[model samples]
Target: MKIGNVNINGKVALAPMAGVADRAFRELCVRFGAAYVVSEMVSSKGISYASEKTISLLTLSECEKPCAIQIFGNDPPVMAQAARFAVSQNPDIIDINMGCPAPKVNKSGGGAVLMREPKLCGEIVRAIKDAVDIPVTVKIRKGWDDNNINAVLIAKICEDNGADAITIHGRTREQMYRGTADLNIIKEVKNSISIPVIGNGDIKSPEDAKNMICKTGCDMVMVGRAALGNPFIFNEINEYLSYKKKLSAPTIEEKVDIMKQHVNSICKNKGERFGITQARRHIIMYVKGLSNAAKLRDEACKLESLEDFSKFCDNILNSI
Candidate 1:
C-alpha cells in the first residue's frame, strides 16, 4: 500500500500504541516484518512547549523509518505547529489522533472528541496538512457512542480536507477497547471514502487479518493490542498472506532471546532505569500464556536494574 510517496512493502502495519509502541518496540516489530510502524501518540501541547519528556518520546532510530508520528490536540494552530516539529524528525507521514477515547484527551477536545465535531476535525487536518510537506493522515473511532456512529462522515471529512489516508478502529468512543470491534462499521467507512482505509481492532491472527481485509475491503490492517507481546504476528500474517503457509509459534527460548534483545535496545536508547521499568510490562506480555506466568509477572514487577531484569528473564526461560 502507498501512502503518498511512501510505499509500504506489505499490508500489515503496526498501530501506534501509546506506552507500548515506543522506539525500541517499533524497530523490533519492523525488523520482524511490519510493513510500517507508527510512533506512540505525542502531545501537541507538550511538543509546542518543548517539554523534555515529549521530546524524548519523539526520538526515532534510523531503523524505524517509513514510520508515522501521531500527534493529538484540539487546536488547529497548536496541532499544526506540532506537525511542523514532527516533520523536522523526518517521519514518513504525520498522523492525527482522533480515535483515542481517554477522558483526559476527550475533555480537552482532542482525540475522539474531535469526531463529535467533524468541522473542527477537518480544520485540524487542513492546518496540519498545510503546516507539513509530508502526507497527513487521521486515525478515528466509529464515533462518540453507539447512537452516533459516524466514522463514514468523519472519513469523508478527512479525505475532503486533504488527508492522504484514514485509519478506522471500528468502535465507538463509549466502547473504548471493550467488546468486539464492529467490522461492519469499518466496511461502511471504506465504501464512503476514496482514499486508502486501514482497518483496525480485534485482529489476533493471520486469518483475522485476511478476514478484515476481505470483509471490509480496506487497503491495510493495523494491529494494536494483539501485537503487544508478539511482534512476530507481523511475519506470521505476512507469510500466510503471501504464501498460504502457517508459521509455528516462537519457542520459549526464542521468546526469551527476543525479550532480552528488546530490553537491550530500550536500555541503549533510554538508559537502564527508565528502560527496565518500561520493559517490565512487555516482559510480562512475552511470557503470558506459559505455566507459572503469574509468578514470573510478580517477580518481574519487582525488577529494579538491567541485571535484575536479565536474571528474571533467564529464570523464566530456565523454568520453561
Candidate 2:
C-alpha cells in the first residue's frame, strides 16, 4: 500500500498506541512482518518546547523504517512546528492524531475533541500538511458520540485539505475502546474519501483482518492491542492472506525467547531500571493465557532487575 510516494510494504500496519507501541515494540513488530508502524503519539506543545520525554518518543531505530510519527495538539502553528520537528527524525510519514479519547488530552483541546469541532480539525491538518514535505496523514475515530458520527465528513475534510491517507478506528470518543468497533462506519468513511483508508479496532486474528478489508474495502488494516503480546499476528495475517494456510502457533519456549529478546532490546535502549520497569506489562501480555500465566505475571511484576526478569522468563519456559 502506498501512502503518497512512500510504499508501505504490506497491507498490515501497527497502530500508534501510547505507552504500548514504544521503540522496542515497534521494531519488533517490523521484524515480525508489520508493513509499517506508527510511533506513540507525541505532544506538539511538548515537542515544540523540547521536552525530554517527548523528544525520546520520536526516537526511531534504523530497523523501523517506513515509520510514521504521530503528533497531537489543537493549535495550528504549534502542530505545524511539530511536523517540522518530526521530519527532522526522518520518519516516512507525519500523522496527526485526532482520534485519542483520553480526557487529559481532549480537555486540553486535542485528540477526539477535534472531532467535535470540524473546522478546527481542517485547519490543523492543512497547517501540518503545508509545513512538511513528507506524506501527511490523519488518524480519526467515528465521531464524538452516537448522535454525532461524522467520520465521513472528517475524512473528506482531511482528504480535501491535502492528507495523503486517513485511518478510521470505527468507534466514537464516548465508546473509549469498550464496545466492538463499527465496521459499517469504517466502510462509510472509505466510501466517502478518495485517499487510502486504513481500518482499525477490534481486529484480533487473521480472519478478522481479512473480514475488515473485504467488508470495508479499506486499503490497510492497523492492529493495536492484539499485537501487544503477539507481534507474530502480523506474520500470521500476512501468511493467511497470501496462502490461505494457518501458520503454527509459537510454542511456549518460543514465546519466552522472544520475550527475553524484547527485554534485552529495551534494556539496551533505555537501561535496566527503566526498561525492566516498563517491560512488566509486556511481560504479562507475552505470557497471557499460558499455563500458570496469572501466577507468573504476579511474580514478574515484582522483578527489580533484568537478571531477575530473565530468570523469571526462563522458569516459565522451562515449566511449560
Q: Which candidate comes out best when scored by lDDT?
A: 2
Residue 29 C-alpha lDDT in model 1 = 94
Q: How many residue pairs clash in each candidate?
A: 0, 0
Question: Tens-digit lDDT track for model 2 on 53-157?
Answer: 999999998899899999999999999999999999999999999999999999989999899898888999899889999999999999999999999999999
Error of 2 at 82 (Å): 0.7
Task: Please provide, for model 1 over 1-320, each residue's C-alpha lDDT reduced to its tens digit, 9 standing for 90 to 100.
Answer: 78977898999999999988999999999999998889999999999999989998888878987899999999999999999998888899999999999999888878998998999999999999889889999999999998998899999999999999999998899999899999999999999988899999999999999999999999999998888889999999999989989999999889888988998888888889988898888988988998998988898888889889878877776776
Off by over 4 Å in 1: none
- Error in Å for residue 258 of model 2: 0.6
lDDT of 2: 0.93
Give the Cα error of residue 296 in candidate 1, in Å: 0.3
Quantify all predictions' global Cα lDDT against the true fold.
0.91, 0.93
Model 2 segments more than 4 A misplaced = none
